[model samples]
Target chain A: MKGAEIFVQSLLREGVDTIFGHPGGAILPINDALYDSPIRHILTRHEQGAVHMAEGYARATGRPGVVLVTSGPGGTNVVTGLTNAFMDSTPIVVFTGQVPTPVIGNDAFQEADIVGITRSCTKHNYLVKDVRDLARIIKEAFYIARTGRPGPVLVDIPKDVSMSECEFVYPESVHLRGYKPTIVGHAGQIRRAAEMIAQAQRPVIYAGGGVIHAGASEELRTLAELTVIPVTCTLMGLGGFPGVHELWLGMLGMHGTVAANMAMNDADLVIAIGARFDDRVTGNLEEFCVGAKFIHIDIDPSSIGKNVRVDLPIVGDAKHCLQRLLQELRSIDKDWKAAHADWLAQIAAWQAKYPLRYHQEPEGELLPQFVCEQIYEVTQGEAIITTEVGQHQMWAAQYYHFMRPRQFITSGGLGTMGFGFPAAIGAQVAYPDALVIDIAGDGSFQMTMQELATAVQYDLPVIVAILNNHSLGMVRQWQQFFYGGRYADSSLEVSPDYVKLAEAFGAVGLRATRPEEVRPVLEKAIRLRRPTVIDFVVKTDENVFPMIPAGGSIKDMLLA
Target chain B: MPTANDEIQRHIFGLLVENKVGVLGRITGLFSARGFNIDCLSVAETEDPTVSRITLVTAGDSRILEQVQKQLNKLIDVIKVMDLSEEPHIARELVLIKVNAGAETREEVFRIASIFRGKIVDVTPKTYTLEVTGDEDKIRAVINLLKPLGIREMVRTGTIAIARGQRVL
Candidate 1:
């Protein structure tokens, strides 16, 4: 059998049902092999779109997303997506085609050193020089991508290797001597953590994307309820705990709620489960949680003390560690609710005093917050929400009450614009009947608007809800406060009519200019049951409040 | 006895890694990407053909040093990382120095080389190439003594370290 045939066979063995990619000259052999295979291929408008779609698929399904692109430009286009996945710890395997082996160094047409280019951004990468190593390399790539701290991996295959014939032998299991992940927590550390939790008078649970990645939401919820600890999530951590739970403190970061930030500031102990203390979350590291003793639980040992020092660090899978922690906590005969009564009351007071608020008159210009609220209302908080990076993204996080893991997928770490549309398309492909909405900004939507064609071609019923503010809202907000309001190059005044663009792509388009029209347009779009774009003309200068200035203490927030 | 986290110190590390293509690049790339300073680095194939040993010298505060070790271990190509500086370890580096040892300076240079137990690898009408091996301090001392004699050129291998006891890395 041919090496390309072996590649397909290996993917089948890995249980890859769908792949996202764009074909080019160097990958012709693999594309030909794919013609006879049963694997579904969603041809994206660009390689970057393909990779983002793969990430969406991976995040939604808890499986590694797959991408196959050709050489040079195709390979380079996926670099942004790879970095995004690497930063967010998304599992994606990208296969880029190389020029024939003989002309690899001679710079033949469309040849690229993609492996070298993506070395720093990818978790791991390979350049397969021989057909014999093709099967094994694919197996290893998939293994490295989906295990440990999940991340993006790339495998570059020379065109000749795909053409060369070989006997296909898919390995049963991968054995990487250098790669071993600790899945079980140390017994002694778990016991110590439990004791610390029981002894603390005021404690807060800070969760991040790692909780969702490890599928530890149920364990985290059980532990939180058992101890009556207030749970706060990062932007990437939304939906890891029920948004409507009594102890939920919204998100805890730059634009976090007043209750969450205050709880973090005043707590005596902080239980960080599968969360990295990112700079966005821990403003002014010198002053962040200065009075709190920390217990950090994560699968990656390196992430434990990378930012803030921790008293106890548990290195294991979040699910396994939380299970052991629950067992240890259950063995104790303490009344956690009684002990934490005062602390809970203090948090409740804070929440009641300064809740998430925005003003909307009876007949005022449509607000982005109002649009997000209507989206939540129309979907009944059940829609899978993806967002581009900006003020609109924060509004969605604030207004949409996500109640399950993998429901709120957004670019948190990398903050890549134009990530939502493709990601929503990927999620829609995974669950065709489910409602997947991309709450996008006008500027961000324009970044990858070409993916509309891809959605139409596949008939994916995904909604692109564009908050058409006619400016890069986040940068504008920053300039308004810090840069003397010099909005240079931040205005998207010469933007295309999104409705026309959607119609050109053979999808339905709707417009909601007034606040009252927001719900009706969303309702109509959902009823269309196909690719629909809603142009929500919103307040141009709206800013996300309760924000701590970069490098400022969380206690000092600009709340208006 | 540096007690504070801000006290910067030099540390020698021994790493066992896979003997595969781009393994060295991966290690060095990680160092550069993470902004960890590498004082010196050396690598060679070990007794096991499938594995290679790397000796890296770096200077950082306690926190930075801990992060360096942890980050190095996180790489897929690195098998194990040992901080040789934490234990009783022997470290050596080889240096080849060519000195302009014409008539008057020749005897002094030769005497200095002899005191350091260095071998005269090459000799010409006006130059002598001396080979020396020692720890960093000894290498620095020898170089300092030979500096006044108009040293022509020099090259030195980075440090390689191993534990003194039965423990192996």
Candidate 2:
């Protein structure tokens, strides 16, 4: 069989129903091979868009998303997306077309040392020098991407290798020499953690993106209720537990709710599941949750005590470890709600005192928070929401009370500016009937506005709610507090008319300049059932509040 | 130790990594990316062909040292990381120094080399290339003694380390 034919067949064997890619000089043969293939190919406007789409697909589904792009510029363009996936641990397989073997070092037209460029960003990568190794490498790449702390993996194929004829044999299983990830928790560690949880009077379940990735939301909810533990989540873990539950203490971190951060600081025990102690989530590591004894459960062995010291660490998949934790607790047989009523009352008081709130100011400026709140209400908190980074992202985290796992997708770790729109397109592709919206700031939306064309071309009904603040609100907010209001280059002076841009792509465009118009416009966009862009002219100086200043402890949060 | 703040301590680490292309780049680039310092580093293929042992000397207290070790383990190419500072280990370095003796200081240089258990690898009209092997402190002492002899050129292979007898990592 020809190499290109083998590539398509291998993808089919791996059950890859969709691929996001862009055409280029080196990858033309593979593109030709995909012509008659059953797989749906979404051609993105740029290589970066393709990778982000692939990432969105991966995060939504547990399966790895595939990408095909040419070498050099096309390969380099996917670096940011790869880094984003690496940090967030999304499973994606990027296949970059390389120059022929003889011309590899000679810098042929689209030649780039892709494996060299992406080495740091990818979990594993390959340059297939032989066609005989192509199928095996593809199988390995998928296995690496989707297993044990899932992440982006790259495979750079030389053009000649793709065109070379060889017998096609796909490996049924992969056995990587240096890679064996822990799948089951240590029984002793899980018992010890249960003992700690049983004895604690005030405990908090700090869930993260890993819970969603593991599809362990059921286990998480059961454990939280059984232990009578208040649940707070990292931004990445927003939908891992029901946000509107009585025990839910909103998103916890730098921009976390007052109730959540305070509860975290005051808790006697913190049960962290599937979340790393990233600095953003823990403002001052030395002073973060100093009063709490920690129980950390994660699949990555390295994340156990990387940031904050852990008392009991379980290295395994969240689902399996969480099940073990529940079993251990049951074996112990302790009534937690009977013991922690006062602690629950204190949390309730804090929540009531300063909930995630923003004034609508109906006749005045269209506050970004109000827009997010209206979206939450209109969608009944069921929409799969993705957000571009900055103020809009934080507001979405604050306002949208996500009730299910894998529904709140954003660039939590890398904080990529242009992630949400492409990610929303991927989510829309995966869940065609479900509402998929990208909550974007004007500054962030412009970073990947070209993706609107891709959404239009694919007929992806992904709604983009552009919170059209005139300046970079998040940076400007920091400048207001720390840098003495000297905005510097953070002020995004020249901006495109987003509604017109969407209209130009043969999509619906709407505007909401008033608080009252916010809901109606979102309703109109959501009803339009097309790739719609809503230009929400928001208050220029509206800042996301309840912020823990950089290097400041969560205890020292500045509430506005 | 309980009350005092974190003061600088020299740390040694042993890392086993995949012996393949770009392993060195990943390791070295990691240090530069994080603005970490490598006081000395050495790498060589181990008895196992698939893996290479890298010994790195860095100056930092416990917190920074722990951070660096964790970061190194995060790299996919790195197989295992061991902090040799906590273990009883033997460290060695080989340094070659060419000093301009000019026939006047030749005898004294030779005497210093003998005290340090060094060997003369090369000889020129006004120079003697003295080769020495020892741990960091002994190597530092030899260099100090050779300073007065007008050392012209010097090069040192960085530190390589292993656990003490009956200890394995």
Candidate 2 regions off by >4 Å? A483-494, B1-7, B166-169
Candidate 1: TM-score of chain A is 0.99
For every candidate structure, what is the RMSD over all alpha carbons to the true structure, in angstroms? 1.3, 2.5
| Fraction of the native A-B contacts that model 2 recovers | 0.18
TM agreement with the true structure for every prediction = 0.99, 0.94
Interface RMSD of every candidate? 3.8, 3.9
lDDT of 2 by residue, B29-69 (tens): 77887777899899999999998999999987665677788
Error of 1 at A530 (Å): 0.6
The backbone clash count of each candidate, in order, is: 0, 0
> Candidate 2 — which pairs collide?
none
Best by DockQ: 1
Computed on C-alpha atoms, the DockQ of candidate 1 is 0.55
Worst 10 residues of 1 chain B by lDDT: B1-10
Residue pairs in candidate 1 whose N, alpha carbon or C atoms collide under 3 angstroms: none
